[model samples]
Structure formats: structure tokens, C-alpha cells
Target: MDDRIIASLETAVGATPDDAVLRVHLAELLLAAGRREEAVRHAATALAADPTSGPARAVLADALDEGAPAPQAPAEDAAGTGEGFDWSRAEQEVGDLAPPMYADGAQDPQGRAFDVEHGDVRLSDVGGLEKVKERLEASFLAPLRNPELRRLYGKSLRGGLLLYGPPGCGKTFLAKAVAGELGAAFLHVALADVLDMYVGSSERNVAELFRVARESGPCVLFLDELDALGQKRSLTRNSGMRTTVNQLLTELDGIGRDNEGVYVLAATNHPWDVDPALRRPGRLDRTLLVLPPDRPAREAILRTHLRGRPIEGIDLPALAKRTDGLSGADLAHLCESAAEVALMDSVRSGTPRMIGMPDFAAALEEVRPSIEPWLETARNVALFANNDGQYDELARYLRKRGRR
Candidate 1:
């Protein structure tokens, strides 16, 4: 069957080297077959064939990201901001850990998102959320940013932080900004990309990814949707997921060596579902609740989307004030809705016109905050699952918002 699949892909590639989709499929197949080098080659070819292709980029990123032991660059990059780390021996370590099922069953880990790139948007780039910023500054950033003070206090940088909140509220965005603030390479690992594979293979993948992260020092490994991987052991029936969680615990504890420069950050919408083991100190112990965007944040998002677009009489302050409870995405949709209204109106009148407050007003009615349901659900979790007061921050936010 492997031979057949390879033969078919080879024939297809021969028939059409210009077909980017076929090349991407061939790349994914090669990757699933454990031919990392070939997979990367095909993915690069596909990307060159179609520079605008998203799948080609994805395949290429996944190949570069997971293959590990990529060739090292000069100590300093063109930006001269940070030096690259050597990932020279990653492939050797992973080869031993990789299970036989991959070659036998053909379970592909690509096609899922795994991105590692540099970030430039700093914490200041984030709109508002003063309290959130303050908490992060005190807990996550202070140690790295203030090395002298950190040494005076004997603070260690090896630890994990878990950010929990409703979806579309910028948990991932904040993670990237945190990386940007540190000027570190950001590796975004969607947990679903790692967890649902064969037995022992999932654990190997988790271990290998962390190995890559450790080698790539000053790297911010942002694991989004962590609950799926760390779901409560009692509630979960899968032994494979449980092993993955244990592997995560081991990696966090820095079992063999120091985790000095590799900062681990994870975000999940359902913190309650995450395994309690993962929350123990020296792991993902510290928790921060990322709530809906405040008025200032909404305004920032609106302005960002509206910039360079023709508009008039758009009272940003008024709209921001009225848009209480809207998430960043919700605010973006509101802006899009208003722009769509103006575009349609211009078409009907056969005269171009700028978007106005009325269109924004109509958008307000159409796009109510999608966070209310999340808030309601959060209220229950905060109130009932206030076990040991972990959800105290959430409870306080709910009470302050008068939604409790």
C-alpha cells in the first residue's frame, strides 16, 4: 500500500510538477511516511509553484517546525535582534522515540497547524486590559525583563503559565505579544495537532516538540487549547492522552536538565477540564483569566481595522463606549458590517460615500457581544468550581461587571 501510494504520487508529480496541490499532498504523504527531508523538499517546491498558497505554506512550516535539527544560521540574524539556536541533534533523538505505527498505519501529524515565527508586536501593542497587563508584567515578564532584580530575589525563569478565557478574546494574541515583548521566536502548537495520534506516538511527539523548544532557547512555546491535551484523567478514558499529559508534566519539571530559557505558555477556554496534575507548582501552576476586550481595546481594534479605509463621521469613542462586552473579533465584525452597509448604500445610490455613524449604529444592533454566553458559562464555573479559590479572578471579574 505504501508503495502504491508513493507510486501514485510520483506519477501525479511527473504528470504535473506545476500542480501545487498535488505537490502539497505528496509532501504530506512523505511526512506521514517519515521521509522528513523529502517532505520538506516537496513542500518547498509546492510553495515555489504557488507562492500565494496557504496549504503550501502550512506544509512547509510543519515540515520545518517538526523535522528538527534544521541547518543552523549565523549567530546573528539580519535584524541583529536575537541569535538563532542550534537544533542539530533533534532528528536523532526523535528517531528512537518514533513508534512503528507511523510507518505501519500512516497517521499524519501535518494538515494541523504548527507555526514558529518571530514576533514584533510588543505588550504595548496590545490595546488596553491594564489589569491583565499588570498581572502579566508582575508574574511572567518581570523575571526576564529585570534580571538584576530577579537575581536579588533568586527567581527562576523555568515555569509555565496558563491563560484561560472565552474564545476569540486574544489569549493567543496575548501569548504572541508576550513573545514579542521578549523578542523570542514564537512556536504556536495547537494541542489537537499532537494528541490524537497512535499509542506512545503522541507522547513521543510531545517529548520531541519540547526537545526542539529547549534547543531553540529564548523560544516561547505557546500551546493553545491545552485542555484537549490535559483533560482531567478521571473524566478521560483514553490512556494515550493520559500518557501525553504525564509527558507534559515531565517536560515542565525539566526532568534531566534546566529549563532556564524556554518559557512555556498555554491557553485554554476550559480550564476546569484541564488535569489537576498540570496545575501543580513548577508546571502550569499560575493561571490568568483573559476576559473580553475593554472599551480601550475595542477602540484600538476598531481603529486598526478602519485605518487606510475611507470613512467619515465615525465616532470611535462613542462606538467604543457603546460596544461594551464585545470581544476583539466581535468589534472587527462590527466594523466590517458597517463598511458593508456603506458599500451597499453606495451601490444603490450609484454614488460613492464614506461609512458613517448610522451604519455603525446598525452594526451595533446586528452584532451583539458573543461573550455573554461564555460569561454565563464562566459564572457557573467560577461559582461552583471555585475549588480552592483558583477561579477567584474570574469571580471577581464577574462581580465587578455586575453580571453575577
Candidate 2:
């Protein structure tokens, strides 16, 4: 089946050499077939011909994962005779496009310095979601900004916020941005680091984490994947797991008004799985639903991802319009796809060109937004488990979107 599609697309591209869209189509087909080299070649050709093509750029971005680009194809063009093409030159051109994807994130926090003064990320850097930003202002930021008023009204310096959403919708990014916004240090905690195989050790780890947060006042301690740390006790018959939840609850409330300058934030894809005790007032009580990136946010995310890469004629507004349901991570993936396509095309045609729109279109068609299943699950929970109106916001969103 793939052979037939490739044959047809190749013929179409051959008949109309200037039809960059056809080349993008061929690039998508080749990419799907795991022919990364061929895909990048077509994508590069498409971009070279029409540098403004979004699909071309999107494909170019995705093919190359940082530091691990696919090997270039043979010197000869597989589609036609290699004329006016320099294979080595084209390969080199692609090498300069995609920087290492993991260079910014995924660093081990244990080995890294996270001093508050070292953080450069600010809320302004976070694009779109004005509503989320507003919520943060009212519930989280207002007191910090207006401390005199907060003191007059009897508000505390510390608070707990639980960010809940589908996977890859920028929860962790938002957490860091919040820390940056507040000029606070960011402490990212993972369950694997806290969970111990020995009896009673996991509880101790939780205590130590809280202790570290208390000592590092004015810090944002972000607990990634909260569901793992505080899952419902009824569901887990394991005594160790229940103990961890109890310890977490104790830490959240603190023993002697101790959580004083530390702000606790937790993110979870499965909020319903979190123990009910954790959601009670004064714990991770405030839940903000981080939906898929809205249109404006999607545009910002795309722009951020493609900023340093070799890109041309990208209509970010138009691209964002086309990618209505994609998450922040999905937009990042689209950019990567664009780069990958350009790289492959550079090798095939022996001409490295800037990424274009055709590559983006091709990649967009292949990479689906990973939000549907999450929404489906959320819808069920909103309808059935939201007995106390806790998920009223989610229910309203589902109904507005006609998913309820």
C-alpha cells in the first residue's frame, strides 16, 4: 500500500518539478515508511522551491531528533539523475538546522544548580492562555504581588495549587514559568526519586522533600506526576503506598505552620486518581485545568520551537489556525518534523534549503494531537465522578465542546 502511494506521489512530483506540495506529500509517505533519508530529501527540495511552504518546514523539523540525525542517502538522487546537486553540501546544511532537543529540558535536577537568581524564564515568555494567567494572578500571584493588602486581609505567603491536565499540555512548563514569574527557585520532584524499595523509606523521602522546600523558602516545589505519590488509598492495598499518602498529607498541612514561604505545586494527568485527602482545602486544593493549547498559545509554542532553526515564510497564525486541537508538545513535534523533512531533502537533492510550509503541512497530517483519549477519560470522570462539583469546570468545557 505504501509502495503504491509512494509511486504515485513520486510520479506527480516528477511531472511537476515546481509543485512543492507534491514533494511534501512524497516526504510524508517516505517518512511513514521509515525512509528518513528520502523524506528529508523531498522536504528539502520542496522548501528550496517554495521557501514559504509550511508543510515543508514542519517535515524538516521532525525527521531529526537532536544529535541523532539519520545518515544521508547515497550521493545519487533516487528519484532522478543528480544534476547541480552537492550531496555533502546538502547534508552539512541540514546538520545546522536542529539543535539538541533535550539540551534545555530533561537535565537531572540533582546535578543542576537551580538558584532563584539563575532562572531566566518569565511569564511573559509563556504565550497565550490569558485565562490561565488571570487565574494564577487572582489565586496565586495576587497575594505575592500585593503583600501589604494580603497582610491587611490575613492572607499567607504560602499556598498550594494543583495543575491538572492531559499529558504534554505544558503543565510542567507552566510550573517552571510560574517559578520564573515569581523570581523563585524551581525544585522539580519526581516520584521515582522519592519512592524507596525499603519499608518506611518512601515516607522519609517525602519528609525530606518538604524539609528541603521549607529550608529553601520562597521556592516553587513542583511535584511532577502527583497521582503516583498520593493515589487513593482505597485503590492501593499496599501499606507502603498508603503510608506515603499520609506522610504527604502531613507535609502539605505542616506540623507547626511550617510551610511558610514555600509554594507547593503538583501536576497530574490523572487527577481523579489522586487521593481525596490531597484535594481537600489547604492541600492541593486549587485545581486548574490545563487544556490543549488554544490557538494563540499554539502559535506562540510554534514560534518558540522554530525560532533558532533555519526556517522561512512560516505563517504562524495560519499554522496555528490549522492546528486547532494540538497540545504544546504536539506543536513542538510539528516543528521537529519540519526540520527532519528539510534534512532528508537536503541529502536527496544535494541542496540544503530552509524549511517551508509544505513540510509543515505534510508533518501536520501525520502527527495527531494526543488529547482525544485524555478528553474522553476526562469526560467520563466529569460526568460520573464529579459528585461535588469539583469538576464543574471540566464538565462545562466538555459540554461547550459538545463532547459531554
Candidate 3:
């Protein structure tokens, strides 16, 4: 076959991709020219476009059989009924050619509807948030671990704890750590998990989330970005969002002890934006402030990020001292920037070099503390909206940092 003729047919097939007849013609020409792979692909595509096309089927079968050993012919009675066909191989060849007609809900492990996790990050693994750890132990872990103590003191695990602070400050990790301490399944829910485009679906999703969490008994249901999921009803203009918040409130206040063994932990960067009802007496009633990493935490964060990378003469203590107010995330970026500096320098000099203090100094010049803006916003909230003393800890921290 002339290559020009094959090219012309390919162009025609490309122009009218849905035309199974054109694709079959191209497949036949390609097959005749000994381009078996290209012939098989086109034939499979044609078969996918028109499953009943006899020419597409014949071409696909011929392309598939081109290099195979021949078997004795099938009995004449069974010839046209697919009895001698390798249907599985044919299906495999064309399986990915057709797009799916529909999509289902997202999948999870073990065929569950939600992505439940088992965390191994204990509180001890979390570095230098001693005050936060102490608060967790006293308010959350102690009560859960000592049921007798809880019963003796009449402390009910009926409400959730909200962790609020700047973004990228390890709130999620702290929630996971709490779950790890409880030795329970962790179901991390975000705003996207509950909201739906269809009416009433969002409410159903919220109810379903709680239902699954309840079924997974002794589970930690960690709601991330609570400000988005349960924003103040007064500020929420979308009726759908307000209803979703209402549904969440209903779930949190589960009927007749339906939420007995479920532990709720929520985190948000803007706790003030979270629905006030969510912080009522029996909901997420407790709040914890997570500030930027202190010196020791900064050192630990820098060490963790720099691990497994080539380094020399890096003074962690000095680096930690210099990065006083940087969040864990900021420290991570600083480490990354330092590595990039070393990498680019080595590339220019045509030699490898270890990441050192000089590279880190350059990174320091580029990656200033990211928590400053968050602290500024927090200062305003603490100074203005903290009439209830709900943010006293935040206020004290701000004052100590001279931001008040």
C-alpha cells in the first residue's frame, strides 16, 4: 500500500473520529502495510465506536492473530457464535478506547464510603508544643484514658475540641496524634466532603458522614477547616451552606447518645468565622490555640526537613534562634530553598556540594517568617472580639510577643 494513501485515510479518520467505517478502512490499510500495532489500535478504536461493525471486528481479530500460532478450525456449528473467539483478549484490546458513560462516588480503602485512616503519630512525636500537649493531656487524653476518673469526676466526653491558629501549623497532625493516643480510627472530613451541587445532597452527606463515624465505633472524626464547613449562619448568604451547618449541628448533637464513642476534633485558621452555634455548650465547646513554632519546635522542624539530605556545618540552634516565629511550614520551605540554592550552585560550577550554612543564609534572606501576617490578624481578633475571654490564651501569647 502507498504510504500517502494510508496517511490520507489516517487524516480522514482523525477528522471524523466517530466514523467507525473510516477507522476500519485505515486499520485494513495499516494491517496490509505490516504495521500490526497501529492496525490493532485503530481496529480496536473502530470496534469501540461501533460494536456491531463486522469489518471492525474482522480487522481487530486479524490484527490480533497476525503473529499467533493457528489452531485447528472450530466446529462448523460453532463458527459464528463466538465459541472459538478469544473474547477476553478482544475486550482487553479495546477496553480503554471508550470513555466511561458515568462516574460513581469516590472510592475508599476496603470498599468503605469514606477514607478512614489509622494514625501512628503519637503526641510524643510532636515536638516543642509543650503547652498544647499539656492541654491535650489534661482536657482530652486524660479523660478518655481513665474512664473511672471520668466517671468519678462526672466528666462527659460529649463535646468536641477545636484547634485554631494560623494555617500550616500542624493542627491536622495534632488531631491525628490525638486519634493515635486514643487508638481509634480517624475519619478526616473537610468542607468538600459534605457540600454537594444537588439540593439536599449536602445535608445527606453530613448525616452520612456521622453515620459512618458512628458505625466505626471509638472513631475520631476530625473536621478540618471548620470555618468553611460551619461558618456563622448570620454571615453565610448561601441557604445551602446554612442548612449544611444546621445538619452538622444535628449530627454533633446526635440523638440519644448516638455519638457516645465518637470523638470530634475540629481545626480552623479562622475560628471566629466558625458558626457560634458550633461552639455552644454541648458542641465544639473547647478551643485550643496553636501558634507559630517556638525555638525548640523550629529546630526540630528544620532537623526533620533536612534529614536524608547532604549537609555540612549547619548550626541548628543558630538557625532555630533566627527563625523564631516561623511556622513548621515556613521552616520546611526554608530547608527546601536552602537545598535548591545548593543544587543550583553545584549545577553552575559543574560539581556537587553539600548544603551548608552559606546556602541556609541565602534561604534565610528569601524565606522570611510566614506566620507574621497570621499573627497580625490574630492580634486584631484578640484585641477586638475577645470579650468572652475565649481567646485569652491567644491574647497572652500576643502580648508576650509584643503584638498586643
Instruction: Give all candidates' CA lDDT scores.
Output: 0.84, 0.85, 0.89
Per-residue alpha-carbon lDDT of candidate 2 for residues 1-404, written as tens digits (9 for 90 to 100): 98998998888888998988888989988887888888898999999999999999988887654228568765655346665567556666787886543465457454333323237677787789888888988889888878889989998654489999889988888888888888877888888868889999999888878777776777888999999988999999999999999999988888765787788999999999999899888888888988888888998899889988998998999999999888888888989998999899999999999999999988987899888899999999998899999899989888988997
Q: Give the lowest summed-lDDT range of ten residues in model 1.
A: 104-113
* lDDT score for residue 29 of model 3: 90
CA displacement after TM-score superposition, residue 188 of candidate 2 (Å): 0.7
lDDT, ranked from best to worst: 3, 2, 1
> Could you report the Cα RMSD, in angstroms, for every candidate shown?
18.7, 19.6, 9.6
Clashes of 2: 42
| Candidate 2 lDDT for residue 281 | 83
Error of 2 at 317 (Å): 0.8
| Model 2 spans with C-alpha error above 4 angstroms | 1-118, 156-159
- Candidate number that wins on TM-score, 1 or 2: 1
lDDT of 3 by residue, 163-269 (tens): 99998899999999999999999999998888899989999998889888888878999999999999999998899999999999999999654798899999999
TM-score of each: 0.71, 0.70, 0.77
Give the runs in model 3 whose Cα sits over 4 Å from its true position: 1-111
lDDT for each residue of candidate 1 in 1-404, tens digit (9 for 90 to 100):
98689779989898988888888998888888888889899889888878998987887888778866867655744456556643434455576887543353336343223446887988888898889999999999988899999999999676689999988889988999999999888888886668756679888878777776766678898888898888898887888877888898888898996677789999998998999988888889888989888889888989998998899888888988998888888988998999999999999999999889999988888897788888888899888878899888889999999967
